[model samples]
Target: MLKIGEVARRTGVSVRALRYYEEQGLLTPDRTPSGQRRYPEETVEVVLLFQRFYAAGLSSRAIAALLPCVNKGHPSTPQRHMLRTERDRLAARVEEMADTLHRLDQLITDADRRAGAAA
Candidate 1:
C-alpha cells in the first residue's frame, strides 16, 4: 500500500484534494493504526479519472453514481440513463461554448476592420 502523500505525488493532486475525495465518498483509503491514509496503486488512475470527470463538469454526486459502472466495466440500465443524460448536458454546454467562440471571433474581425478603415 502506498501512503497518501505518495498517491498525491503520483497523481499530481494535492493532499487536500485527496482528503476531499474521501469526504465526498469518492475515495476510500485504508487507515493505518496511527490513522494515516494508505492507498492502493490503482488510486493514481482513479484520481486521474476523477480529474477528467471534473473537467467534463460532472458533480461529485454524479461521479459517485458512475463509479460502480466504471469499476464493473458495464453500466446497468439506470447508470446508462444517467450517462446519456450527462452526455447530452455536456453536448449542450459545448454548443453554447462554440456559439460564444463564434461571437468573440466576429467581434475581433469587426474590430480589425474598423482599425483598418481608420488607418
Candidate 2:
C-alpha cells in the first residue's frame, strides 16, 4: 500500500488532483485509521489512465461514463459511440494542426527565398 503523497509523486499527479479523482469515483483508495488515504500499487495505472484520458480531451463526466465499460473490458454501444465521437474530434484537430504546419512551412520557404534573392 502507498500513501497518497507517494502515489502522487510516483504518478506525477498532484495531491489535489488525486483527491478530485477520488471525488469523481475514478479511484477508491483505502483509508488508514487516522483517515489517511492509502492506495494499492494498481492505482498508479489508474491515475496514468486518467491522465491519458484527460490529455485526449475527455471531461470527467465522459471518463466516468466510460469507466465501467472500460473496467469490464468491453464498451457498450453507447460507450463505443462516445469513444468514436471523441476520436473523430481528435482526428479533426490533427488535420487542423497539419494544415497550420503546412502554412508555416510555406511562409518559412517564402521568406528564405526572398532573403536569397535580396542577397
Q: How big is the positional error of residue 30 in model 1, measured in Å on the Cα after superposition?
A: 2.9
Give the per-residue Cα lDDT of candidate 1 at 49. Answer: 96
Off by over 4 Å in 2: none
- Score candidate 2 by lDDT: 0.92
Return the TM-score for candidate 2, rounded to 2 decimals.
Answer: 0.88
Q: Please, what are the lDDT tens digits per residue for candidate 2 over residues 1-119?
A: 99999999999999999999999988888998999999999889888998988998899999998887767869989999998998899999889999999999999999999999999
**Over the stretch 1-119, how does candidate 1's per-residue lDDT look in tens digits?**
99988998998999999999999999999999999999989989999999999999999999999999878879989999999999999999999999999999999999999999999
Please report, as a residue range, the 10-residue window in candidate 1 with the lowest summed lDDT: 68-77
* Residue 85 lDDT, candidate 1, scale 0-100: 98
